[model samples]
Target: MKMIVGKGSCGIAAGANKVSDSAEQYIKDNNLDIDVSVTGCIGMCYLEPIVDFIRDDGTKTTYVLVNAENIKEIIDSELKGETLTKYEMPEVDKQRLEKQTRIALRNCGVINPEHIEEYIAKGGYKAIEKCVTEMTPEEVIEEIKVSGLAGRGGAGFPTWFKWNAARSAQGTKKYTICNADEGDPGAFMDRAVLEGDPHAVLEGMLIGAYAMGSDEGVIYVRAEYPLAIVRLNIAIKQAEEKGFLGDNIFGSNFSFRIRIKAGAGAFVCGEETALIASLEGERGMPRLKPPFPANKGYWQKPSNINNVETYANVAWIILNGGKAFSAMGTPNSKGTKVFALTGKIKKGGLVEIPMGATVKDVIFDIGGGIKEDRAFKAVQMGGPSGGCIPADLVDTLIDYKTLAATGAIMGSGGMVVMDETTCMVDMARFFLDFTCKESCGKCIHCRLGTKRMLEILTRITDGEGKDGDIELLESLALNIKSSALCGLGQTAPNPVLTTIRYFRNEYEDHIYKKKCTAHQCKNLVSYTIDADKCKGCTLCARNCPVGAISGTVKNPHVIDTDKCIKCGKCLSSCNFGAVIVD
Candidate 1:
């Protein structure tokens, strides 16, 4: 029997290392002939610290939420040829990975990432082999065009369109760049791919370099992802030694090499021009794009740039054939998309579903619905640069056109779920604050405009808003979208604009009534004691950080409104649910 422990960032954070160490010790202590190994996250983050037990018969059983304490019992049961049913993954979570069409994440969590042989066993670099040996560069571009794969980084630009442009561009020196600097909040799809299946991304980059006629490539990944960088550096070295990368790859006339450039985690650098500027050692800011990267980029040479997910799908399209991928999704958006499911979701992890699947299908069927069974309020799509999609539109199809119609683009695939207790006005404020701080100050419209919008949102949530504030926000949003220098500033007002479009009443309530309906904004919330439910436990008083709650023993507790600070500790501490917020 062989045991493998998940060691991705999520797994490590959830104590998978401790579980692995204990399992290893138990195996050594018992003198068992079982093999122990490690791998990356398989997108089931909620069931993390996962342990996979494989029998000699080739059957694999996954144990979820494993820790140091419970691993010995599992090891003992396995040695005795007994089934440990309690540690097995739930049927619902089992269905999670089984349900999605995994092209990019095909090798993720299934193979040992540190070893290139495991990746090669899964037919990893065959795409580049086929591209160099079987098909021509133009033929590869044609295949991508037939596949209908777009830029998965939010903008739905055709993959082949950019490749062909860069290939045909009038430049002696050309470059291929992978935009792995994913800055969207709550988004970790790229990080997972890098940490779990770095070779797949490298293989995709290899094929892209061959297709784009580039001799050099750069993966501009974020510095925040230490594991991803470490794994990537390892993958590159392995690929180099295997001849899948570096001079005369696969013994062909073609030669391509890739380098890693660590970014400082700037949000504005997500834009191609700004990324190009950063690559040139300038401040990460956007420049006017008449010579869009294809014609002139990266040190003023012709370059092609795509996000990690977009390139990760390349080898799959090459192997599976373009028509096979194009048949899966709706008319416009083809193939599958990966989303980092987060916030109030039950199965909060990485989800890859077909493009046409309804939001309800992802959130309910796959995600297992909201946490604590709370009433669904809205989903913040596309990060701060995206919009809030309300519960009424949960059935909206997960396509670029459909999501864009609701004022939210299918961004880098960060789906933040919100419950009924979430204050939409305050939520808008929070996102605006992100965009405001992240602004690069390159263009006056984006620099001053987003700051002004954030100030307005702050005032509204702070109970100091006026009647024309909504109109003022709308006007600013429209102008910024039109006049801003780049995509970041243009899309900065998405949270504010979409909230006004769908949930204007929430903003109005914050301004006109000075009452937070969800009781989320601390400035607008009032804590009170419910006489009927309070048992004078003094638990609330003891837990209060500000000493807000006080009362006699065996009597109902009272919350001092002035000293309350509007913290909800009292509400959670009371066993009878005596504390109330209004």
Candidate 2:
């Protein structure tokens, strides 16, 4: 029997470690012969610490919201072949399962991440084995081409084209780089894959290295992801020990080695050129693109860079053949895309859905709808550099072409769902603020343009927006999108542009009426006392942090408008529902 505990970052955050320890203790205390192991996330983040119990008969039952307290009962019931219906998370319909295809995330939440043998046992390096033994370098590229696997790392560029370009390049020292430097604010899909299935990514890299005839592979990982780094280091050491890495891998004449290059948490480092510069021990910044990475990259040699998720998919495509993988998703965009569905959504975690799945299905069906049963407003896909998609367009198919056509890019798949309480103007301003700080300052449009746009958004959120502020924002967004050099700057205006396209009325209301429809912009709200319901409750007066409320023991409380800071402390303290924000 197999009893697995979720060990992803979200699971860890929800006390999965304690759950694991408790399960182990319970097993030992009960003298059970069950196998208790740790795995990655199962995407249901709302019911984290997800425990999966697989019986000897291969029937599996998943227990959601599993905590330390429930460990003993789960072990006794599930491990002992007893069913605990009370602990099981209700299974969704078959359509939801059919909509998802787990190619990149196949091994995730299935194997113990720290153990290399566990990964190997589950057909981990079969692709590299097939490639080294039977397939030639060009044949491997052709398989990827047939698979129609584009880069999952935001750009959606053809993966085989990148490999073929590097393979065709006239260079003695070509390079293969695994871009683990995922800098998107709400995106942890790459980090999860790296942490959970490092060997899968390494196997993909090995395949790429063999395909492109590259001898050296570098993993450009961000310093912030310590767990991923640790797991990656472990996987590298294990692979080298097993002769999967190092010279003449798998007895093949093709010699390859992989090294780790730590990034200093720079968002620009995710770009190919900037990642190359950082790997070269220089400051992370983007350069010109005409002489692209394929021709001249990474110490002026031919290089191919793909993000963690993209490389993770390579091994599967090689093993399963192209047609098997290509038949899953949309015609233009093939295969499953992993999204870190977060922000205001009920089930916020890693979700791997097929490319053609609509945004509505992702949000409502898989995500279990919005938190607190709030009305759906919009979803911000692609993180800070992405755009806001309105609730009306929820049925829009989520693919690279569809999102791009809607003036948004399928950025690293950070789907941040926003409810009715989220202010569109505030959302735009928040993302702009993030980008302004993360700007590499390589281009003036990204640096100054983002700052200016952030200022306008800030003014609008603060109720100081003028009639022309919206027009100014639109103009600046277009200029930035067109004039910027790198992707950071090029897509920096996405939030503003998409918000203006979808929630223009909210912007107009803020600019013209000086009111926040969502009541999110604190500056536009005023706290007042409803005299009829005050009941002379001095509790509000005493609890007022700013001393803005004053009243006698029996008389109705009144707020001194001039002195009130609109903090709403008295409102929360009042039991009679006297305080109101208008």
* lDDT (0 to 1) per candidate: 0.90, 0.87
TM-score of candidate 1 versus the correct structure, residues matched by position:
0.98
Clashing pairs in 2: 40-109
Candidate 1 shows a clash count of 0
The C-alpha TM-scores of every prediction are 0.98, 0.95
Residues forming the 10-long window of minimal summed lDDT in candidate 2:
91-100
Best by TM-score: 1
* Residues 42-147 of candidate 1: C-alpha lDDT, one tens digit per residue: 9989999999988888878889999998999988887677769998898878878889989888878889899899888999888889899999999999999999
Query: Which candidate number maximizes lDDT?
Result: 1
Each model's total of backbone clashes: 0, 1
